[model samples]
Target: MKRCFTALIALTGAALPSASGQGHSALVQLQAHHSQADLEHMEEHAHYRYVGELLFYSSSFLVEEGGVERAATEQEVLGIDLHAHDGLRMVDQRIAVHDPLIDKHIILLSRNEFGALVLERLSPLDRDAFLANKRATMEQPSSKTQ
Candidate 1:
């Protein structure tokens, strides 16, 4: 009985999904193309979802929420921005209506008390790809062990 239980546990553990493993390779490929400045800019903004060429930022603000009643101080707003110049050409404008997670990021862009862009989320795939490529490039062959 103990042997059977152990086997079942092992099988279950093996079958469980690993969210990090599936998409990381593709993400690594994607990151190779971006520059450090581009990454820093994205990081400064709020969490964003990558849908094709656009990054959408969404946040709940203090504003009226419903009708007939007094406008609530809080409201939710979605903001969209174009990330790539090539991708921008495909869209009608540089900015558009915020659409929720069509890709990866969930938080989207967030604003401060003064209404300035403060945080942004990168797609996990994008991050993984970027870091992996960087690691690979930084690896060097050495003739002597130190």
Candidate 2:
């Protein structure tokens, strides 16, 4: 498993390989080659099936539930917490992330004293930008060692 990761990192970009593994990074990479509608449909379907859901996209989450539902603005969210949750034991294991057995990151963009703020924002990106960043990242050197 580690060897595979090493090879993938070597093949892709080396810089910030850790951050590149975050929830959003997957979407960015996929969207680089896919249509936005297809991406949305898949993520929404994944959420419905309790397979896997996107954690963040600039502001929008691939799926939303309970408290954290959407992309939040600075004023709308004072701070955020990324934790783990053990649901009904259904969410699929993504990229060898043995979530339920291990701890998964559950993101929270909490409300303020007034109430949850209605953020006026756009989706962090469309396919074009995602691909551009991905291309750039792939060209960078791996800075941190495994």
Candidate 3:
């Protein structure tokens, strides 16, 4: 079963379009390609489903600030908590990270083949939308199987 799954992933990854086009880095292409509709398209692949769950999750990020690389503080990591049920959302290779340090600044992070996390994009989340998402998640019942 493990071998079969691995084979499936290799094949599926090969079938996806090449994102390493000229002028744009692979990460940039992936970010641009993974719109809501593109994500829906990727959802059909078994590899996407399996690998999405298997990617690494980090609690602290080493980010460059003022010409110096420093680890992000807990507050700088945004929407990150050891006890929170879910902190990050991943689709394909991109994950959304919310940092509350600057008015809910959200960044999309991508995991490279070498397992390093890279920042792809940064966008601000409106306060109202953020609150709404929080409320909706809190209202949902747990889907735990056991």
RMSD of each: 16.8, 17.4, 15.2
Question: Per-residue lDDT of 97-142 in model 2, one digit per residue for the tens?
Answer: 1223213333333222101111111122323343454456677756
Top candidate on TM-score is 3
TM-score, candidate number 2:
0.21
Alpha-carbon lDDT of model 2 = 0.30
By TM-score, highest first, what's the ranking? 3, 1, 2
Taking the tens digit of each residue's C-alpha lDDT, what string does model 1 give over 33-122? 455555434434311212111212122111222322121111121221223212322222222222242221222222232122112223
List of clashing residue pairs for candidate 2 = 14-142, 15-142, 59-71, 83-106
* lDDT, candidate 3, 20-137, per-residue tens: 1211222232334356554444333333322332221221233444455543333333323312313453443533344443333333443342123211110122223334544566
Q: What's the C-alpha lDDT at position 32 in model 3?
A: 45
lDDT of each: 0.27, 0.30, 0.32
Q: What's the distance in Å from true for residue 125, model 1?
A: 20
> Which ranges of candidate 3 are over 4 A from the true structure?
1-60, 63-68, 71-125, 142-146
Best candidate, lDDT = 3
Error of 3 at 48 (Å): 23
Candidate order by lDDT, decreasing, is 3, 2, 1
What TM-score do all the candidates reach, one by one?
0.22, 0.21, 0.23
Q: What clash pairs does model 3 have?
A: 78-99
